[model samples]
Target: MNITKNKFILLFLCLILLLIASFFLALSYGNAQIPLDSIADIVINHLVYGIKSNDENGALYDIIWLLRMPRIILAICVGAGLSVCGVVMQAIVKNPLADPYILGISSGASLGATAAVLLGIGSTLGENFIGISAFMGALGISFLVLFIANLGGPANSVKLLLAGMALSAICSAFSSFIVYFANNMEGIQTITYWLMGSLAGANWPLLSKLVPLILICIFLLWSQAKILNLMLLGDDTAITLGYNLQIYRQSYLLITSLMIGTIVYASGVLGFVGLLIPHLVRMLIGTDHKYLIPVSALIGASFLIVCDLCCRIILPRAELPIGLLISLIGAPTFIYMMIRKTYSFGSK
Candidate 1:
């Protein structure tokens, strides 16, 4: 046991170092071709002392601090949050294929945001009406999924998945219906961008709210690591071991919904990070949640920072959507995994 624990600690340290390296690499490379030294200087000034400049170097500083930094941070936070939720969801449901979005939360958030934009249903709220609407939608769908899954018997993995899919279909249909009839060109344009998922809109104010929420969720889920390990043994065995997963499952889902709502509100539906990173980490470290959660978070954060850097530099001037980039990369990898029979969505 001690040896296993030591190995996990070593893996965690290695992942953290990798994350820092990726962060530096992400800061250094971009289309404008800023030198690594200049980037380092800006980061040092911001981190070490409060220095504000608007000169050429300052403009670079601003771009790094205001534009690129927030986006990178957003990527990291969203990646970590999604990966953490993915780990928790998989344990709760005892399904390797489970993800944070599997319970229809992302769809719900999307529908809410879409309605707010196209229909202007929540326009009277304020500047953040779209985000608020998204939160409500995600929460609503979570509740619906929980209720539906608990209908016949104990909330099991199969039932939870089915409920989530069904609710997701319903929310998607409603969103499309609103999009179809809405004659607002500007609204449609905004909706399209929101769907594609970009970190271009990252701002400090949003991050201030989002980062703390995500941190709290990560902490809560991390503390449940032991319980998550027991969950893989199935309900009957888990019950004999004296752990009641019912409340834990529901509570984690709700917390995850809150995190997902904020993420969707911040960066639309950035998919695959949650599903892929946790699975990959599990493959490396085994299914022990104690090691899986934090390590996956670090890997997820590093993965997005790199991916975002690619999206910035890969094009001539314009930026590509991160979600599209993830899909392009993830789909083929997923196919390869399926063909190799390494790990799959095979039923229990």
Candidate 2:
């Protein structure tokens, strides 16, 4: 017993070290390729002496502290948030394919942001119009999906999945229709990037709110680990064990939708983290939510930070969209997982 416990402790400690290493490594590389020591100096000097280093080297400091830092941090939050949400959503629906974005939330966000950009409906919201509109769209679509799923009778996992797909299709159609009619080249470019996802919007002002929301959601989801585990055992079995998923499912769905919506508003649509990260963690640590939640979150954070770094360096003068890169990687991994019978999505 002690040996197993000790092994998990050691594993987690090592994971923390890995996360720190990844953070520093991400900070060091970008278009300019800043050095590790410079990265450390910028953070340490600013944090300790309460001074902003400005001069010849100040430009590097600004790039790291202002640009790279916030984006990387946003990547971590979105990655961790989406990964944890994926784990719970999969458990809620008892389907391995489930993810935060699999529902209509991300599409809804995209639609809202696209409308704001192209149609100028929410342009009056000020600088954060896109984000504000996206969040509203996400929340509204989530409620719509839930309401639709419950229209005929009690909502089930299958119903939720189906309803999400229906709304997602509807939202996608509207987005396409809007673009098709707009005929503005510059507007099209902005909408394209927003749909593809970018962390370029990261900054302290937004990060301040994003970080706390992610932390709180991760903590809340982690606390529900036991309930999540029960959920995987099927509705009948969960009820027999003194738990009711019907009640808990909506609560979890609502919470996850909020987290995903915030992420989309902050970072745009980042796919596959939710779908890919949890599955990879399950392969490493099995299906136990207690272990799955945190491990998946950490790995997801590392995964996105690395992906964001790749996007920056992969192209010389231009950067790639994060959503595009993730889809490129996620699709292959998903195919491999589905082909392998060993993992079996969930317990038989």
Candidate 3:
């Protein structure tokens, strides 16, 4: 017991250090290549002394503080949120393949975004039309999935997964229909980039707004770690032990949707962080939600920050899409893990 506990503590500390180091690595390795010392100086002077980096108007300071900071922070928030959600969804559905997007939320958000960009559907909602539409679409799909699952029976994992797959297909079909009929070349280009996911739209206002939501959701999730463990025993076993997963499942789905919507708003349709991070963490820590949730959050945040750094510097003149970059890396890693038979996808 002591040995296992100590390993957990050690790995947790490493995750913290890795996150901090990756933050600086992200800040320093962009196109203009700000030095580590300069990046630290700018951040400390502005944050500790209540000074704005832009006040002195150095381009490097401005770039680091103004441009890179928001993107990096948003990346961390989105990564952590998605990774934690991935863990929760897999637990709820009792399926390793379940991800944050399993319930069609991503497709719903994409459909909303396509409508806003091509048909100008949300034009009256002011400048943030696309984001607002996407949020509503994701939230709506979550509710629809829950509703469908609850139709004829007490919504179990199998029903929920099936409902999600069905809704996801419908949403994707709608998105394609709109894209085909609209014939708006410019909007199609925009949707293409947005679908591939970019942190370019990140800003101070959006990051500040999402900070509390992300932090609160993660805390609530961590608090529920004990019950999540009980859930893995299957419904009958959990019920015999006096834990009803129904209310918990619905509540988790709703709360997680907020985080998902926030990410879809800030970054757009980035995948794999949710699916990949939890599996990696579980391979090391076993199935303890106590260790899994927080570690997954930390690793997820670090992974995205580091990946986004690669996206930015991989090309001299243009940045790679983050979604594509992550998919390229994550797909093979997951395949290798599956092939190794080290971590079965919920199979005992």
Candidate 4:
């Protein structure tokens, strides 16, 4: 036990180092390449010494600071948030295939975003009305799923999963309906791109709000690691151990909903990260949520940073959507994992 714990501690340290390296590496690559030292200097000067960019270095500074930094930060937050949520959701459902969006949050957010963009449903809100609408939609559908699941009795994994699937299908249909009938081609195009997901819209002001929220959610989930471990042993077993998993499952769903809603609002719907990262971590470190959550968070953060970097450099002039890149990488990788006979959900 001590040896295993030591190994995980070492792994955690290494992952933290990897995340830091990925951050710098991502900062250096873009449309206009900035050298590593220059990137470091600019970051240190701006953050430490409180220096602002001047004429000669202003363009580079803007690229690194104003644009790339926020995008990368958002990528980290979204990736970490989704990965942690994935861990919790899978435990809640006791399903190896479960993901953060298993509760229909992504589809609901997409529906709300589609309505805002195509039909101007939330135009009266503010500059970020679309995001606001998406957040509300995600949260609303999550509660609806809970309510439906709890109709006959306490919600269970099967009931929650079924409710989520039904609501997801409904939301997707509504979003498609809105998109198809909308006369605005521009709005339609915007919706298409937004749904594909991009970090281009990331900004400091947004991150200022989102970063804290994501960190808090991740921390809260980590604090529930013991309960999550109990969740894996089946509800009856948990009940025998004096833990009622019903309330815990509902609470976890709500927490993940908020985390995912914020992610969708900031970067649209970047799928597969949530589903992929947690499993990958579990494969390496077994089913212990104490180690699983933090490791998954770091790996997810680094993975998305690299993916975002690829999006910027993949095309000569134009960038690919981060979501598209993630799917391309994640789908094939996941298939390989599925085919591997050695891999099992809770195996050490």
Q: Identify the candidate with maximal lDDT.
A: 4
Sort order, lDDT high to low = 4, 3, 2, 1
Give lDDT tens digits, candidate 1, residues 1-348. 112888888888888898888887877778766677888788777778767664657779877888887888998998899889888888877777778888888889889999999888799999878878887898899999999999988787678889999999999999889989999999999878777788888999999988999998899989988877777777777788887778778887888888887888888888888888877775576676777888889998999899999999899898988999999998887666656644433123
* Model 1, runs deviating above 4 Å: 1-3, 54-56, 152-154, 341-348
lDDT computed for candidate 2: 0.86
Number of colliding residue pairs in each model = 0, 0, 0, 0
Better of 3 and 4 by lDDT: 4
Give me candidate 2's TM-score against the actual structure: 0.95
TM-score of each: 0.93, 0.95, 0.96, 0.97
Q: Record all residue pairs in model 2 with backbone atoms less than 3 Å apart, i.e. clashing.
A: none
Q: Per-residue lDDT for 144 in model 2?
A: 88
Model 3 CA deviation exceeding 4 Å by range: 1-3, 54-57, 344-347
**Which portions of model 4 miss their true places by more than 4 Å?**
1-3, 341-343, 346-348
Q: Tens digit of lDDT per residue, candidate 3, span 47-123?
A: 89976656454787779878998999998999999999999999989998889999899998998899899999888
Q: Candidate 2 on 185-239: residue-level lDDT in tens?
A: 8988987888798999999999899899889989998999888888877788877
Cα RMSD for candidates in order? 2.4, 2.0, 1.7, 1.7
Per-residue lDDT over 266-307 for candidate 4, one digit per residue giving the tens place of the 0 to 100 score: 888888998999878877887888888999999999999999
